[model samples]
Target: MNIEKLDLKSPDLVNENFEKLATLFPNCVTEGAEGKAIDFDLLKQELSHAVVEGNKERYRLEWPGKREAIVTANLPTTKTLRPVREDSVDFDNTENLYIEGDNLEVLKLLQESYLGKIKIIYIDPPYNTGKDFVYKDNFSKDAQEELIDSGQKDEYNQRLIANPETAGRYHSDWLSMMYPRLKLARNLLTDDGVIFISIDDNEVHHLRKVCDEILGEYNFVAQFIHKNNSNKNQANLVSVSCEYFLCYSRDLEVLNKEIWRIEKKGAKDIVKAFNQLKKQGLELDEVLDEIKDLYKRPKYAHLSRWNKIDEKGVFMDDNLSREGGAKDYTIINPDTGKPCPIPPRGWAKSKVELEKLREDNMIYFGDPSTPPRIKSYLTGEDLSVPDSFWYIDNSIDTRWQKQTFNSLIFENPKPLELIRLIMEMSSAKDSIILDFFSGSATSAHATFQLNTEDLGKRKFIQVQLPEFTNEKSEAYKAGYKNICEIGKERIRRAAKKIKEETKADIDYGFRVYRLDSSNMQDVYYKPQDYDQNNLDLFGDNVKSDRTADDLLAQVMLDWGLPLSLKIEQIDVSGKKVFKVAENSLYACFDSGIDEDFAKAIAQDEPLRIVFKDNGFKNDTAKTNVKQLLKQLSPETEMKVI
Candidate 1:
């Protein structure tokens, strides 16, 4: 009986791609020195109907390090995420996650657990304005070390390099950095998923081409223009007062065409006010007068036409005439007991539909003289398709951020309304939203606000690198030594404010995890390099300073389980056991494991189980435990670290 050891690494995407291609074209697969490899010559012939040409010229977006970027994305990582209990809000119960690390490594670790699970992704990456720094992926460590030796990188290991305009590879470096991260992000989206990227004029054209290549040009949705600032008078050429959001869908055909609508501006406030007046038992005349007065306010003035009310609700008189003259129909007015005049063009609805509308009290006639108009109820006609242009004041967001933290800790934080608008139009009530470039956690803040408004179950996953703050900046002075500190604090403040103001019963907590080296010792991965002289040196495979919680997290990642699942600690026969998601998995890292504890745990019949390699009292005890589980709980799949 063989007990398998868990592989503590991410999925090798290159091997998986080869296997997929082999399944599709068996004749094009051949065994190579490394293993099964694709014969590109034969594969090209198989895909083309005509004779294929070698090194044919084609239109493509490429840069100096494009190939290396592709290779980086296909490679697997040996890193793991260690939970930070002291920094987390509610570690055991919350589904939201806040991860701190290099986003490239973080995205690779999340490939298996969150594949095709996220519904919406919004990122506000560095705009590459020649002053801001871009992520240095360290494709070649020698090059990175050279940069560090030259004083390019700070001593804190921020993994960022400034791309000045004078640099030879200004655009190339930025493109290479964004390529692999976008490629990895695409794998985490569902069929109907969409991504929105906030960019500026500095690199919008290049970024658009990169997205078109990765997400396919046919899936391009729209380029929304946001007039965020209107007072930029310091431009040498032209005053650029706006930025852009490039939107793309994973599969355009899978999205519902009608789902891109949002409630009209100020519609919710109008409904709330109307409902309040009616609940007070005001007379119909008094209610109409009060509603008219409410619409006179500057905020609700645009919807003044919907001032009339009836037993159903507030409504506006809409023209019943069709533009091109549809079926003509007339009906008698109930108030005047006479037939109303017909519209010149014709009624929009057919005779049968018109009769149904009259029965439902959806038509209004004035004294039987004017043509009858349809009554468009506010409740039924409140939604409208969002436009491609948005005009929002930037100072409002700055003021709100100041109020939230009681200080301007972060610079140029994304507006909460902008993220909330994107989420409202793209996501569902119970969707998972991800922001890999979450600088100040605005995406998570938006998720909490939206869920509070509708009592939704939306969850968010925020990923950011712990870049050091400038010593002269206000954030550094406020004791926020890194960007991650500001982000986590902003989330806590936002959640508290929303809960206190609305008394919302939603998930107001998040679990914090930081990227680190794997829990396994070097010998566990490279046993072939050791000889008999040093064989006994590694009595245990796990590192000395690592804890059981670290081991459990890596095990969950290796087994393709989400880190947000519930975990329960159990004590049985003087040993500790972990039960995850009830019966989905069971793990025990305790020593002195015997047949009695195995029998006790086997009775639960968990689908999967894991144990430490040296946790048993003796070799005989380990063998006996395996055999006992095979007989007692035959369905349970067991493994060891």
Candidate 2:
């Protein structure tokens, strides 16, 4: 039971998010009469032509609850993540996290620690095809009121149900749900980070427009066509077998600077050609000649473009003319003894640069009737650039996903290879990937799979609300109560399988945390209202229901420390003392703590310390403890509750 002292006051998310924005663009931040506020005029100036101002028929996304959604994103929650040790794989050491909660509130909670830290975000949100559940966030209602008003009961006490097409705010409700989540998600992305959102035709356009507004229109990358559900049996009117993945970058300029590309298939063919040529007992030059000749075959016709064979190997000719802008110039053909006809976009290189190409025999002049082209060698490097079209190959498809769960526990779970490709293309070896809408935990499974394949150390943070499964559904019959249960099991199964198969040193583990009300009691919030008679009762403000471990977890969260860190308990002069992050913080919540206990803790010189105010028997004892700490660990900041 890792319950902590409840804190009623929520973390100020709006202010925190504003501070981050101010850090990025200080000129755009200005002081309001009341407090810090954004100067829209200055912000517009900073963005230059990118700013969309004035309501003069400009293109933008609109919905009934758009303003409320923005407010919901800015609104803070008094919720905290309590560790569920039994459900977790590695309770203390894993970098991966599986959070069960409303993702909007969770995103706000994560803003401070995870801001600008995530490398890739891949979310398969509800498609809002009139049957999917649209998150209803009663932004104006407090936690308890929200639960009672929504008529939801169970752990976490939130309502989730499918929104049918018959609802009046069909599209608006869906938009409202997504707007805040996307807005907060952008704050978590690194400058070069990218996001991939999977959606169907139903709301793809709305999703694009919302993303454009939140992530900036300039960052739009591509809408990739994934041919996953291509079976015509499921199509109603047209055989709509393909879905879309709308990719966007946090900053296009930053992503462009990296020059990213996905590795192409057909490397096996290149390897096969090399081996076949070797078997023919041909010399190196002869092998090159044979390979070049083989490329002309109809089966391998795509390779025919590399027609020239030289010391640099099989080479292709590229037109010498520049692309787009033209730089006109004339040059003698040398052999022809006359200048060749200039291309419309003139030569790309100057006379001196062209002379270097000629000297190195990199200019192809075999076609004397035409302008010479620069020679480009085709080495073993068979690279292909990623385009909007993503045709289905054996590696990508949902068949394996359905087979893994065995009961269609989740509909249309993404293929592991599909997500792996996104991670490989967009993230570094040690990147951190996030998926708030992590149905069936496919993103988590894929991340682990990629790590095993490349021996990389990628990590993931998965967030999903515990939406209840139908009582008569396959998942419920299998003893799973909610969607989160199924998602967790999938990850557990994936981890065990990967470990058994690879037998390699990998982090196939995750910590599970459930979002709930803070552990502090109600009296802790309105202490000023209490008279001296109740002062003694309020002395122990920590909730009686919360355990010492719970309070420690809350302190760690309030301090912005990772919740998965190892916690150590030690006995100090007959009292229990807690140490976290290897002496980074120490706390003694037990009562009857004497000067000896305080002295023992202070002697360790921990960086930060916390104690219960009534732990001491009297003021004299407390004063002695403070004096001891002041002398032994003067730098250790102390707090009392």
Candidate 3:
């Protein structure tokens, strides 16, 4: 396939000033192609600023189907990695899934069962490091009915070809690669969804723009500063210390707090309360302020007046909220070794306040032995100050992207802790989380972990290209041949970890699929003048081993439609295609798209009808397809396998 790259400089590149700086994988950023790699340095010049582009939150693609969401008891369309039975893919039994094929296609395959469902999605793609890109061929300009004609796409891509150096449109290339995929990812997130992207200075800006465009600019949550590489070599300028985590959410409002909270060491009041009650049988309030020198706070009990505590939580009353209360008070200054004078109004406890204090038994002197003092237990304010910044150490590096980019796998990859942190504060557990550039499968990891903690059944759908690895890299040694390989392994490992750790009885693994040709093979059409039996138009006619999602793509193709069209898998019917341009087509490859099924499909006045030739045992009935087409749908075009 001849790959025609557009202009070297993406002229209308509104996101950033990309003319400056060097890059590791130049192809990752470009114009009129997949996408532009982000410039992490430029994007993080300041935490709030980055190269901005189109509205970050607005999506370029509008989802087409909403009606056919249910899954049916039986399906006759294409093959999918669906659970044959409820227990087939038990949420509690297995922790990982290794799906073969394209990530985009897989995302489509998963749309039905896992919408707004994943907790995290981590992916490490071809950094567009020109030498490592490996895009599979789907078709070409020629009248090619088939290429590989297999489920697996050949490994003929950029890795073998000369690397395309970073061009003037550096960021453009990476942006193009990310945009559409990100749009698709948006659908798979739970409300409290979070996405984490791992990128250096090269194309961070482009990522931010793309994220903002698809995830909503308002959803730009936060960027975590991560030390990606520990620079040891000396340089002319400052050694770059970190990578940025581009984060966003499904919805920004209705966020929750306390999801990522760690209980602080017991507050001082807690210790005092427990010790006083258990050891002394005395309420803290009963003897808190009876008699102690201003400078003698640490050893007040040494005075020995309150030798034995007899009560717990027992206290003298203080009338603070009462009208005209707290008329008398004693003020002491420890530093000055003196007492501050009472106010002209006769201290906070004036005559009126004094009378109230006496009634509540709120005053004491010479410690508890002489008398008990008032203790206001109600004074505990909502005053625990949470640190504004999350400490890097507290962030759990999840098991994702461990073996990617050769020897560059981040061991103990940063977990979706960062994602969870951002997501919990801005989304409900059910919001969608779109992570276009998933690396190390962290987003998915975080989502799964969060689900166990949340107990709220949220779903996730991930999209990642099959970015190959350098066989010699350290990551490859750890057992991954490509970035996608690592991604799959991480999901599996995460699943296992979750199952063992949480023992959840709910479903979690994603139904895996990938981008590919339709499951239906190129129709073996005979010339119009041929006189042999038109047996092709019979039942069970489909690519013998293609995937269900692929078959859906074929349905679009035979009907002259775009492969990217939306499809829904219903519980009662199997796969349903919608937003059908020009007309509608219902196809099934099951052994028999029988008479009952045919009639079922015809329930709607579709524009066209195509089915498996094997489904019709009666030749006469097969020929009646044209007549049926006229009656069931006058405008419908009917044909057989």
lDDT of 1 by residue, 193-300 (tens): 999999999899989999999999899999998876554346788888788999999999897553788767677777787788889999877888988887765445
| Sliding window of 10 residues with minimal summed lDDT for model 3 | 65-74
* C-alpha RMSD values across all candidates: 13.3, 13.0, 14.0
Candidate 3: residue 145 lDDT (0-100): 37
Task: Report lDDT (CA) for all predictions.
Answer: 0.85, 0.79, 0.47
- Which residue runs does candidate 1 get wrong by more than 4 Å? 1-57, 142-157, 229-233, 268-346, 350-381, 524-536
In terms of TM-score, how similar is model 3 to the real structure?
Answer: 0.51
Give stretches of model 3 more than 4 Å off: 1-166, 186-198, 210-219, 224-236, 249-388, 394-412, 419-436, 501-510, 524-540, 547-614, 619-641
TM-score of 1: 0.78
Pairs clashing within candidate 2: 3-550, 4-550, 4-551, 5-519, 5-520, 6-518, 6-519, 6-520
- Candidates' TM-scores? 0.78, 0.74, 0.51
